[model samples]
Target: MKNKSIQIQEKHHKELQKLSESLGQSYGGLVEKMILYFKRTGIDPDDLKNESPTYKIQQLDKRLVSFLKVQERAILKPLRQETYEYYENHNKTLKEAKSLINKKIVQADQNSKIRTNNILKEIDKQREALNSICEHLDPANKKGLKTVFQNIFKNAN
Candidate 1:
C-alpha cells in the first residue's frame, strides 16, 4: 500500500480520536471506514448531523402519502359525487318513462273496453230485431214478413 498524508484542524482531529477510541478503531482505520461508508452509500458526511438519509426517506414517504390524500380529495371525491348524481337522474328518468308507458297502456285498455261495449250494444239491437222478425214469420205470413223487412231497411237508412 502507498502512504498518503492530509492536514485537518486540531479540534476535528481530537474529536476523531475520541470517536476512534469509543469505537475501538485507530484514527486511520476510522477514516478509512468512514470514506468507504460515504462512497458506498453516496451520503454527504458534512450534512449527516443536520439530516440523515433515514430522516429524508421518512419525510418523502410522508409527503407521498399526503399527496395521495390531496389527490383523492381533489379528483376522486367530486367524480364519485357526479357519478352518483348521474345515476340518480337516469333512474328518475327511467321511472318517469315507465309511468308514462303504464298510463298509455291503461288508456288503451279503457278505450278497447269502450269500443267493445259499443259493438256489443249494436249486436244486441240487431238480435232483438231478428227475434221480432222471427216471431212474425212463425205465423206463416209472407206478406207481413216482407213488410217488416222493408220497415227495418228504411229505419236503418
Candidate 2:
C-alpha cells in the first residue's frame, strides 16, 4: 500500500508533535492507538472525523439523558426527599424564630414604657410633696423648715 500524508496547519502540527513527545509516542503510534480505541469502543472513526454540529449536539443530548437517568436512579432519590424535608423544617424554624424575636421586642418596648411612666409619676409625687412643705412652712419657723428639708435629703441619700 502506498503511504499518504495529511496536510495540517503548522500550529496544529506543532501541537500534535508536542503531544506525541509528551506521551512518548510517534505520530503513527498515536494514530494507531486512536484507531484501536475506536474499534474497541465500537465507534467509527470516520463518523467522528466528519461529524456535523447537529449530529454532535444530538450525541451530547443522548449522553446527557443517560447521565441524568443514572443520577435519577442513584443520587437524586435520597437527596430529593431530604431536600424537601430540610426546606420545610428550615422555613418552620425561621417563622418560629421570627415570632419569638418579635414577641421579645414588644415585651421590651412595653417594659420601657411602663418604667418611663412610673418614673414620671414618682417625679410628680416628689414635686407635690415639695410644694406642700413650702406651703405649710410658718413665716416665723424658717429654721425648723430648713432642718426638716435637710433631714429629708439626708434620709433620701
Candidate 3:
C-alpha cells in the first residue's frame, strides 16, 4: 500500500504508536480498521463535523492521549523494568537451586557407595573371625566354640 503523511498532534501520534504495538499492526492499518468499524456500525465519518459543541468539549476533557502518555511514563515503564528484574532474579534462583540439587545428588551417590563398601568390609572381617575361631578350636574344644558362636549370633540379633 502507498504511504501518505498527514499532520497529527504529537500526543495523538504517540497514542497511535502504542495502539499499533498493542494490536500488532501499523498505525495506518489501525486507522483503516477503525474506519471500517465506524462504517460497519453505520456511523458516518463526515458527521463528526456536525457533532454538538458539548460532545466535542467532552472529548477534549477526556484527555485520553495525555492519559496514555502518563500511564506509559509513570506506570507502565517502571512496571516493565520491575518485571524484567523479577525474571532475572527468578532465573538466577532456579539456576542456583538446580546446582545445589545436583551437588546433593552426587553426595548421596557417594555416601551410598561408601556405605556398601563398609558393609562388604564388615562381612570380610566377620568371615575372618569365624575362620580363626574354627582353626583354634580342637574336637575336644568344639562344645565351647559352639557356645561362643551361639552367644555371638544372639548379640547380633
Candidate 4:
C-alpha cells in the first residue's frame, strides 16, 4: 500500500519522538502503530477530522463503509458477548473455589483444637499418676522421687 505523509507542529513532532523512544520505536513506526491501535479499538482516526470547523465532507465510498460496518459487527459482536460470558463463569468458579477453601480451613482449625485438648488431658492424667505414686512412697524415698517428678512436670509444662 502507498503511504502518505502529514505535517505536524514541532512540539508535537518532539513529543512523538519521545513517545517513540519510550516505546522502542521509530517515528514512522510509531505512526503505523497508532493507526493499528486506533483500528483495533474501533476508532476511525479519519473521523476526528470533523473537529475542524472548515472541514468539508470528502467523497466517502458508501459501499466500502457498509461492508466494513457489516464485517466489524460480524467479527466483534459475538466476541464481545463471549468475553462477557467467560468472565461471568470465571467469577462464579472463583467464588466457589474460595468457599471450598474456607470450609477446609475451618475444618482444619477445629481438628487442631480437638487434638490440642486431647494432648492437654493426657498430660493432666500423667501428672495425677505421678502424684499418686509419690504419696505411696516412704518418706526418705519420697524426697528424691518428688524432686524427679517435679522436674519432669516442670519440663513438660
Model 3, span 1-157: residue lDDT tens: 7888889999989999999999999888899898897778665767746675578678887888788999999999999999999999999999999999999999999999999999988977986688577657744555677567657766875
Q: What TM-score quantifies how close candidate 2 is to the native fold? A: 0.44
lDDT of 4 by residue, 107-126 (tens): 99999999999999998998
Winner of 1 and 2 under TM-score: 1
What lDDT score is found at residue 143 in candidate 2? 62
Off by over 4 Å in 2: 1-71, 138-157
Q: In candidate 2, what residue range of length 10 has the lowest lDDT sum?
A: 138-147
Q: lDDT per model, in order?
A: 0.86, 0.83, 0.84, 0.82
TM-score of decoy 4: 0.50
Which model, 1 or 4, shows the larger TM-score? 1
* Model 4 regions more than 4 Å off: 1-60, 138-141
- Clash pairs, candidate 2, are none
Best by lDDT: 1
List the candidates' TM-scores in order: 0.65, 0.44, 0.48, 0.50
Better of 2 and 3 by TM-score: 3
Model 1 reaches what TM-score against the true structure? 0.65
Q: Find the candidate with the highest TM-score and give its number.
A: 1
